[model samples]
Structure formats: structure tokens, C-alpha cells
Target: MSANTLRAECATPGTQHVETGHRVATRSAVLRYPSLTTTVPKEFVHRASVAEVMLTDWERREDHRFVVTAQWPRSHSFFTTANGCHDPLIAAETLRQAGSLLAHAEYGVPLGHHFLMWDLSLTVLPEHLSVGDAPAALDIDVVCSDIKTRRGSLAGFRYATVMRRAGHVVATGGASFTCVAPHVYQRLRAHRLSGAGAQLPLTAPTAPQDVGRVSPTDVVLSPIGQRDRWQLRVDTRHPVLFEHPVDHIPGMMLLEAARQATVATLGEGVTPLSVIAEFSRYAELDAPCVIEARRLPRTEHEEAVEVTGHQDGEQVVRSTVTAAASAG
Candidate 1:
């Protein structure tokens, strides 16, 4: 078969014509060609937003390694920021996406939530690539080095991601992920699926420390509604509970918990859309703080909420969240 025909057959999932069982799945298929040479639509390119840099048409050899290319658009929103990265969550999700691709390709099963990310070590290199800069393209590569399993469960996988502009490395990071069972994976999986991913179930809110409480707070607040705004206070004793020895709470976990708390305080049913947050200062494990959310304008599709985290009357993190109305 011609090279084009071979690539086409390989890109098609569940196609009988492909000899190797290792077919490219939905997310991984983007990496099959050198710089997006495949016939996928341009819309997928746009939807990826900041990830367009890493979803190139780079050729993949039989060794399971791939290279993708992207250009840092000068007009992109992240260019003017301190880190110059729009969202840390996107970085985390990119690692997760890479891990999912590796897991499916190596183990023949989709990755799920049974495993959580315990740690991530990231280094944004000094090199900065601007949109209008002479070198317009960036190189992104992901590779898995070690995978461990225990008791028939996915213990974790260690992988590295490198981001480069014009052949120069701009950012690099390593991630670790634990795996869970297929059923548990399904619930989390449903969120990404169509129709199912539309809205999260609005149940009574629970605090991180409420597990041991004989009577937990059952107040189900609407995080978004006609109300003007919502406010939250995240007070904790010195030596905050579950504070990691690393001096920083896991960014993703803490952000999610804070989002939940904001939603609970709003007293209006709201489904979280996206949050762009920055970790300005570290909160003392024992230090108590306040997180406040103010409702902003609303569009037909989403409502905007502004959030801020403060400790000892000083701001630590600030975020603006967009959420959809709850299904109920």
C-alpha cells in the first residue's frame, strides 16, 4: 500500500485493514502525522486552544515515540502573564492526555480515575517564544519511561513532556499517575463523553474535613443563579490538615476543592465550566484563609464567577470561573 494509504488505514480506529492492533485513538490520532498531515478538520485544531502546539503532524516510528509541533501565537491570552501560560490545568490535562494515550497503546485499556496525580515536577525554561517571533513553531514530545502495577491495578506511570519553540526547549515536566478500575473510570469517563459531559450532578456540598463529622453540612447551595454573588471562608488551624510536606498543596486538587466550596456558597445550582487560576503564594498548612467568589456578567452559554484566596488578609491566589447551569 502507498504511504498515504497506510497512514489512512492506521489512523482509522477499529478498521480491519490495519495489520497492527496498535491503532491511534481519538486523542492520539492527532500525533500520527508530522505536523497534522492527516485529513482531520481544522476545527479540532481550534478547539484544542493552547494545546495546538503539541498536536502536530509529526511522524511516528514503530518505537511508539512521536513529535508534534505548534506555534505560540503572540495574540494568545497567556503571553502577558507572569508564567506566560494560560492555565496550569491545561498542563496537567496535557500530561493526563499523554498518559491516556500511552496506557491505551501499551495496555489496550482506557485510563480512568482510579489513579490520581500525586506529584508533578515542571520547569518552564527561560526561552520564551512569542507569536510574532521569528521562530514560529514549537516542538512537543511525550514519552513514557517507567510503568508500575500492583495487585492487578495500575500503580502509576512516569512520563516526560517537553515543549520547544524553534527547536529550543521552552518547558519540560514529568508526571506520575495512578490507575483505577474500569467501572470507576466510567463515571469520570462519562464527563468527557457527549451529553453526559454536559453538567455535573448537584448534590449536597461536603467539606474536606467532614468525613469524620457525625453530622455533615447538608446545605446544597446554588453556585450560580440570579443572586448577585457568593463568598467563602477557608479557615484552618495552624498546620493545615493534609498539608503536604512539599510546602504546596497539589494544584489541581486544591483548585477543585476550592471550586466546590465556591459552588456550595453560591446557593445557586451551577456547573463548573473552566477555571483559570494562578498560585501566587503558598498557604501555611496551619494557616486559615478565605476564598471569595463574586458573580460577574452572564452570557447565554455560561456565567462568570471571580474568586480570590486570602490568608491573613493578603491575597494568595485569584481565579475567574465560568460555569453552566446545573441540570436540575
Candidate 2:
């Protein structure tokens, strides 16, 4: 195989050869060599809009190891901080896109397959995230491990990433997700496949400053009567969060809710620097999901908050967010 070649084999019985140009997949196998280009296909990242795709290009270094490149604008409409630094969640989004791209473009997972993220974690240095005069070019070194395959198709994998800017380490993160074929996904989401009429009434969000956010539209938690608790607000009309329609709440929205809940619990002047999250099940949009945050035993330099989301008496997401005082 060549440096850019990706080999895929079809093991299913009675399957005939399917050819696309020079590539063919029969009961045997085939090889595909991606052209070297900076433009990443939006479908590889599972994004509806090309503008939302973070990855610019990727190259396989060796088996299970790859290098992915991305570009972060000097200013983003949503992923910015009032403290003049970039939001740490940007790392999370980049990590998510990088993994999805690798799975589809490298591992031979079809484009129509669905991904179920089991867990995600990211840690960033505050000073490293400060917006520079120009857009930041990032190179991410990714190592995929514990790969699972079935019927010669990728089932799932866990990957770790280290992001660098100008040779300086900016962020480190990892995530694990499983892939489901189209038919299996349809069976899994039988009745709730469509997003039509699945959204509930919009509730009023808390003050933007209270949650360390500048825009009310970006806040994902609505204040309730109880302290350290809020209702997860679902805004299907939001341009970025709900870029395209889906039947359930987006994982990024849940992550934002967790960040807001932590900020609210820890008071102002603190910015989240690390986040570790686990998703047990999908958060349906039609039901009310309650978000709660409680302070954990403080460390010397950081404060931790455990944020949980409960829908219909079942926990859907649990995240531990660690924050530190913003750099002056």
C-alpha cells in the first residue's frame, strides 16, 4: 500500500464487486489513495455546512496514527470568551470532528453511518488559547487504539489527540465513539427518527453574565427555583447548535450546558479549562431535561464541578468541568 492508500475489504457473503472509478470492493478487497489536498470534505466530518468543518486535511502516519490540521479564526461568533481567550470547548469540537473524519475517510466507515459518542475529555492551557493577531493554524497528532471491527467493518475506536500551535501544545484530549450502520440506526431510532415536532417550548435562559456567556442565545441553561440547578433549554432554531435538524439534543449543547452549569455554580471570574463527559443515552428534545451542578473537593489550583443531566428520571449526561480564574 502507498502512503495515502487506505485498504478496505468486503467480507459479506454473496456481495458482488462494486466499482467507483479506479476503486473496487468485492468479496476480496480494494485500495483507495486519497489525493493530497487541504480542503476536507464536509461529509467526512459529518457537518451539514462547510463553514462548520474544522479539519482542513489529514494524513495517515502509520497504522492507527495520523496527523490532522485545522484552522481557528481570530474571532468566532460563538466559540469566544469575554476574557479575551478562546473557549476550551473549541478543542472538544475539533477533537470530535477529527475522530469522525478519520473514521469515515480512513477506516472505511460509510458516510451514512451514525456515530454514538460514549465519552469525551479535553484539557487546555488558558494562555495558549488566547486569540492571536492572525488565525491560529493547528496540527493535531492523533493515535487511535483499541479498535473494534466486525464483518470487516469498523465498529468503534478510542483516540487521543495533542493539538499544537506554532509548535506549542495548546490542548490535549481523547474520545471514544461507536458507529452504527444505516439500517441499524433506523431500527435504533424507530419512532423518534425525525426531528419534526420533537422540540419543546423554549424556556427563558439565565442572565448571560451569570453563566459566563456574552450572548443570551448561547446560554443553554434556564434558571429554576432551586439553587445550583437549572432546566436544559433546547433551542432548535439556533443556527450553530442545531445547524441541521435532528431528533435529539446535540452533544455539543449538552457540553455547553455543563459548562454553563459549572460557571453558575462556581461564581463569576472563573473559566472552564478542562472537561470530562460521559453520555449514557440520547437526550430527547421533546422532554424536559434538568441540569444540576455541585462543587467537588477543590484542588490547589482548580475547582471542579460535577454537572449532570436528567431526563424522565434517567441520567443522560454526566460531566466534570474544572475551571480556574481567568488570566488577567
Candidate 3:
């Protein structure tokens, strides 16, 4: 149909597969699609660089179900892990891009619309995340639920995704978000829209090794002279975290802050395997944001921590990170 729209042809069970543009073949449980050779349009994922787009292709199975494909490089500039496992945040970003792509390509959302994330979570099997010699090919089965609409335009929805690598389950996660038109987003944001506000001065960051990060630039927490407490480090100049200009701190950045805080709280030799982050309000860049972590009751199997971000005396984000001793 249109360039921005996705066209899919479904095949019935026990029929010879036909390939044209996009084909969907029914398997026992998961649907299969043709091998994807290129990434989707960068705009669909709301990314400025094509190198940053993780979604390769998507095919709608039903009104609310879809199958998507993606490829992860053996090494990533920002998502690399010192523990020799693929960064779990890579799964988080892939899930995020899948939702954004589906909203624009399948659900008829305009490109200029804004999606506000309410919560995002991912749980991964660490064994399935090791970096191999070749790039990782992922098949994601996604189901959209709690669909909402207003004035014939998508308003919000919740989605759950199961990501698989080479027929083995790698990660499963879900998120909920609401879409707002450009004018409505402007009204809601008032003067603090993207690229309009100034950020607080960049503070000295904590040691990268203490946070499970190899690069100091990747550390998102600054020392506050208190145990389990630090100030949020917003480095807009960062190439990966701040890939694009924005008025306020991004939810992904806050998630990274939560991850680092958890790592710092739990000490060394631990790797975060599960992360759950909920956003109550935006963490403004102009004001200082405080990040605090408290160890949750530890279990025999895994240790968990609760991290909270506060800005201007208000709670902005609360995250729970569960980490186990890394085998590496």
C-alpha cells in the first residue's frame, strides 16, 4: 500500500510457502517470516542513526499480535558487557523499538507523535546472552493488549514480548505507554520540550569498575559522599545515551542509572539479570536528580535492590533490579 505501511501475506498450515514482499508462515507456536536483510526505517524507531535501529522487520499476525525480527552485533559501543554477556539493556532497547515500530507501521500512528513510557521491564536468561562469533538473530513474538483510542487515533496500549535466539528463549518483557499528538505533547510539556531546556552541570562520575561499566562515560551515577546514594549524571554530550537531543532525561538513562546503582550497592562479581522500572514523572535536567538504592531482602538464589530517583523533592522513578553472582 503506502511506503510507511507494512504489508503481510499469511500462509495456512501445511501449505507450500509463498514469498513476495513479506510472508508469514504459521508454525506450531511461533510464526515465521522471511529473512530480513535491512533494518526498518530509522524514523519508525524514533532514532536518528540507522546504526542504532535494532528492529529489522515486523509482520502482523492478527489484530493485536505480531512477529518481529532483529539482529544484535557481537560488540556494541554502549551495550557491551564486561562480564562477557550481552547487555540486558540491549533486550530492553529492542523491546522499546519494537513497540515504536508497530505503533507507527501497523497501528497507523503518525511519525511525529510522542510515546510516553509508563513502565518497562525485562528478565533474561544469562546463559542465552553470551556474545558469539556471529551476530545474534532474535525473533520476537509480541502481543498488544489494553488497546486505547481517542478520536480514531491510538492513545495507549500495553505489550508483552518473548525474545528468542536460535530457538531458545532469551528474554521476556513488557511495557505500557501512551501516545500523544504533537500539539498535545507540546501543551503537556509547555516550555520544557525537546532541545529547549538546559541541563544541570555535569558532576564527577563514580569509578566505572564499581558500577560494572568499563567506561567512565557510561556511568550514570555520581558520588554523593553517602552509601547507596548518588546524584544522577546527565551527560548530554554522550554519544549513545543522549544520541538525540531531548529536554528532559530519557527513561532509558534512568534505567541505566538504576542498573548502576544496583551494581554499586551489591558490590562486585554480580550481574543484573532482571530489571523493572516505573516512571511516575519526568526527571528534569535543569534540577538535580538524586538516586538512592536500598538492598532488598536477599534470597538464597539472588540478591535484589530497590532504586529510586527523586527530583525536586518528588519521586520520579522507582526500579527493582535483581542480580545474581556472575559466572564470568
Candidate 4:
């Protein structure tokens, strides 16, 4: 069947009559089908492919709730020299997309602006999930709990997300996002609310801790206390810092910035082998920050370093980066 026809059939209601053991009975029920069969729009599909190496299916559970399922295909692009997970941001972005889908489904609106994931804290569970050519599926549940205005006219939502694989918790995290009136969002919101503006109250969190100033050229080249390890820092306002919108600063980009800083700290002529990161909090824009690293104890063949990002006297991100010497 054509995609459109299949979608219509799935959405249409059908009546069914049943006979119980004692007597005949009639009831109305709405048939529900797997969201995978409900193809995602072409634009969204393309966006998903480019944003992350994954595909997602979304189903509306209620006016304010949605279930999003995502599958990440194993490929060379996601592999590392160490042969484990290549990028932690892959999972982080997948979880972000799941939350975005939930918001769209709940509000019956299309995403208007790019999402800025202001904060994320994740722990790699003891159970190692698969990292291979086969596809791995994750079920995500999201909820918006607080709404607030900040940094002038920006409206933000505090979101909580839960991720699962094979009925086991893989990760759970929260984030804050500001909504903008983009063409798609405007059209969807108009259709859903019939042109009436639905205003939700704002709920802003307390101010974050303050770290020291970070300079754009603050490169550590190598950790002061360890060999083959490095540390560095960057101001958020640096030109190279805001180049990629997809990374969403403070979220993925900040992690990359931290990684790059660590590489710089390793000084000249060193290349990274792998990087594993765990986000802890938001790193505000235009704020001064500090990054520190030290060599971790490793085997003869592998080298590792412990890296930390701090802003306002609080630790925002922690990472472990490993690399091999050019000749070794």
C-alpha cells in the first residue's frame, strides 16, 4: 500500500463486536499500530540521518506524553582504535532527539528552532551495550516539568528523559531548551491551538557556580604532572567555539572543545586515540572556564588521561582520553 494510504488506514477507526462466555458484548476501541510503520516525514528523516547515525519511531501516548524508539546502526564511522564506543555524544544526541520527538508529539507542533541542550549528565552503566554493525535499539520516555524565561526573552523548558534497552535502564538525564518561532513550528502550533497563544509559566533554575576565566589560546600541550597527557581551556566567546550548531555548545560542542583543549595540552605532534566523556552540568556561554588533565595508569600498549572541565568553582564535565605516540 502507499504510505499515505497505510497511514490513513491505521488512523481510521473500525468497529468490532465480540461474544463473551455468558453473553454477547459490544465496545468501541481504537486500533494502535507500531509507529515504525508510520513513516517519518522526509525532512525529519533527513535531519535525523544527518544529526546522528540513527532512525527513530515516535508514538503519541497522551496529549502530553510520547514514546520514542531509536536504532543506531553499527558502522565503521562509529568505530574507534580501541574498538569500543567511538563517541559518547552519539548516545547523548540520540537521547536529545528522543526528547524533541516527545515534545513535538505532545504539543502537536513541529520543531521551530534548533535545540540547545544546555546540560546533560550521563553514566556508562557497568553492562556494556553492543557497539557493532548490528542495530541497537533504545526506548526513550520524556517529560517537560518546568517552564521559565531567562537571559531576556528566551522561554525554556526543563526536561527529564529516561532511556532503556532490552527493558534495562541505559541512561537517564535532563536538559533545558528555549523555543523559537520558526516556520514549521508556527504552522504546527497554529493548527493545534487554533491560533490561540498558549502561554506556560517560566521556571528558571538557580545560578550556576563560577569558574575562572578561560582564554581562547590557553593550550596546555601536556599535563604538568604527567607525560603524554594534556590540559587546556577556551572562552565560550572564541570564534572557533560557536561554529557548529549541531553540537549545541554546552552539550556536545563543549565536550569537543574540552577534547580539543586536552589535545592542545598534549602539545605539538600528538594524536588522540579515543575519548570517553561524562557530562555533569551546563557550561554557560561567554563565561571563563578551566580544563585540567593528568595521565591515567595504563597498559604498555594503551595511554589514557583524566580530564576535567570547571566553571565557577564547579566541575561541569569529566573525560578520559587516550592516545598513542606516532612511533610506538
On lDDT, the candidate that comes out on top is 3
lDDT of 3 by residue, 1-328 (tens): 1322433434445655455568654352345344327788899988989899898878888889998999998888999865677889999999999999888888889989988999999999999999888989999999999999999989989999999999999999999999999899899999786546666889999999899888899899999899999999999999878889876889999999999998898886677889999999878989899999999987778889999999999999999999984443
Task: Please write out the lDDT profile of model 4 over residues 204-261, one tens digit for every residue.
Answer: 2111111111332322122334443333333333333332332113455555544455
TM-score for each model? 0.40, 0.87, 0.88, 0.49
Candidate 4 is scored at a TM of 0.49
Using TM-score as the measure, what is the rank order of every candidate, best first? Answer: 3, 2, 4, 1
Per-candidate Cα lDDT values, in order, are: 0.45, 0.87, 0.88, 0.49
The C-alpha RMSD in Å for every predicted model, in order, reads 16.6, 9.8, 7.9, 14.1
Over 97-203, each residue of candidate 1 has an lDDT whose tens digit, in order, gives: 45554454444344333445544544443334323434245566867667677666556677777876657766676666666676765665554433332222333
Error of 1 at 235 (Å): 20
**Runs of candidate 3 exceeding 4 Å displacement:** 1-36, 194-197, 325-328
User: Candidate 1's C-alpha lDDT?
Assistant: 0.45
For candidate 4, the 10 contiguous residues with the lowest summed lDDT are: 204-213
Q: Where does candidate 1 stray beyond 4 Å?
A: 1-54, 57-93, 111-115, 133-136, 150-155, 184-328
lDDT of 2 by residue, 1-328 (tens): 2223332333545557888899875643333333443447788888888878788878889999999989887777778855677778888999999999999888999989999999999999878888888878899999999999989999999999999999999999999999999999999998787644456899999999999888899889998999999999899888889988777898999999999998888887677889999999999988999999999988677889999999999999999999884443
Name the weakest run of 10 consecutive residues (lDDT summed) in model 3: 1-10
Clashes of 2: 0
* Residue pairs clashing, model 2: none
